[model samples]
Target: MEREESNNNNKQHFSHKHILTRLQLDEVEEITCNACECDVEEEQFYGCTDCKYFLHEECAEAPRSIEHRSHPSHPLTLHAAATYSNQSFICDACGYVGYGFCYSCAHCSFDLHLFCSTLPHTIPKEEEHPHEIQLVCEQEKLLTSDMISICSFCDAMNTECWIYYCETCNFGFHLNCMISKVVEEEEEEEEE
Candidate 1:
């Protein structure tokens, strides 16, 4: 049952082809995160045999800095994992528990999703929404303490989840929410 559950979880996490491919292991490649203990497949998350720069796939995609579409005023920069004063971060993506790799606007103290920070400046119209997304910076003065926007993909308020949006067409979606939804749908189909 344990093996069965593990197989099921792997299927739920990644497409069969993605997960089934044999891992490319090398003696030179160093193990990065022991906490997650996830294996490397085609492309490594972040690593170099010579230097010590390494991160999880989740971490590599994390925004060192970004301009969010919804809260465009100032650029959201990635802050190293640290304890926050009053507000703490919780990634709606992957449901990982930690307090680093957060997106913040130095000008307005705006918080955001790390995955949202990694969103492509221009999204494919064929994916879901039919529009090109350009990064938008929020002006410090215009930003309110509260976030007021809805995710076009999940149809949820964009409070904790940051988003990608096309201003001309008004198309928007949460970065991680969209990925999760697709993965969930695939798993549901497999179960059926």
Candidate 2:
């Protein structure tokens, strides 16, 4: 059985070919979003029951283009896939490879993962530091050595992933590490 629900303020009408509906999950299912190719493991999602197209609630509601703080020079546009190839894209925010949706700048070839595009501009200062951690896009020309830089949290070499840096402390964090930290902090606050 199926049910139709009214579109909320967040939902945008993409096309008439697909009638998107909100889906309620009763149990865990391995459903992937058609837009970002990420797992729809959340309790609710928007989907096209007829075409089997699905999107995470956030992805479905994301603006067509946004002026991200990280890349202030130009606005990033949300795209189903890379314009040039069907191949995976390297996320400029996290530095990881992704096959799904991306927020990209056509002029600079800069791309960020759909979720990464939503990361906050700054993070609260950790106990070890006195200043707020700022999310930055490292410049390729700034690399003085061919060696990889180690992430302060994961202790992994940052060969291609995005990084969080503190200029005063000369400290750096992997984008994934920062994302996890933010999530953990939010969860902790929710519990209190």
Candidate 3:
């Protein structure tokens, strides 16, 4: 009886291990890298686990999506990178390369970063300016060329993307730049 119980315990443990490995694999999907254009198996970043869907970790964690949050009274959606006609924009999130993923108020020209749009009214920064950044309008201050100016957000200069103004200061950022910060944080934590 003792031997049987030990054997059964081992079997159950093995089963559990197998299930865990499968779960990890399930979180991964086949995707082509935008940079290398090579096929690679990438893990899903942020998405619905129940659906038969997954995005590349980069795609999933994209600071902006087609969905809109309730803070704004308008709906925002994602657009292909090529669709943008304006210039001098940046993602206020990861500082990546895009004017694609953005949150916009359909009723107005109010645009925000996928990440910045979701930030609370105040943020605690360890560096740079002391005061927390808040959202403000830059439409009037924006030069016709400003529309094409390189946004401090998303870090990429010359790309057309959603723009946001800091209420605390006249600072501007792109959506992707903000998302870059999140990615950097995650990477640093992993290194530790």
Full-model lDDT for every candidate: 0.47, 0.72, 0.40
Candidate order (lDDT): 2, 1, 3
Model 3 segments more than 4 A misplaced: 1-117, 121-128, 144-172
TM-score to native of every candidate shown: 0.44, 0.70, 0.34
Residue lDDT tens for model 1, 24-110: 345455454311223344243434323322345565444355656655567767765423673465543323343435666666555
For model 2 the TM-score comes to 0.70
Ranking by TM-score: 2, 1, 3
Model 1, C-alpha of 188: deviation from truth (Å):
4.7
Model 1 weakest 10-residue run by lDDT: 1-10
True-vs-predicted CA distance for residue 191, candidate 2, Å:
21
Evaluated at residue 22, the lDDT of candidate 2 is 81
Worst ten in a row by lDDT for model 3? 1-10
Q: Is candidate 2 or candidate 3 better by lDDT?
A: 2
- Give the Å error, residue 87, model 1: 9.8
Count of clashing residue pairs in every prediction: 8, 2, 27
Residue-by-residue lDDT tens digits, candidate 3, 38-101: 2335432222233322233443334434444432455565432323467323443333433434
Q: Which stretches of candidate 2 lie over 4 Å from their true place?
A: 1-16, 126-131, 138-149, 154-160, 176-192
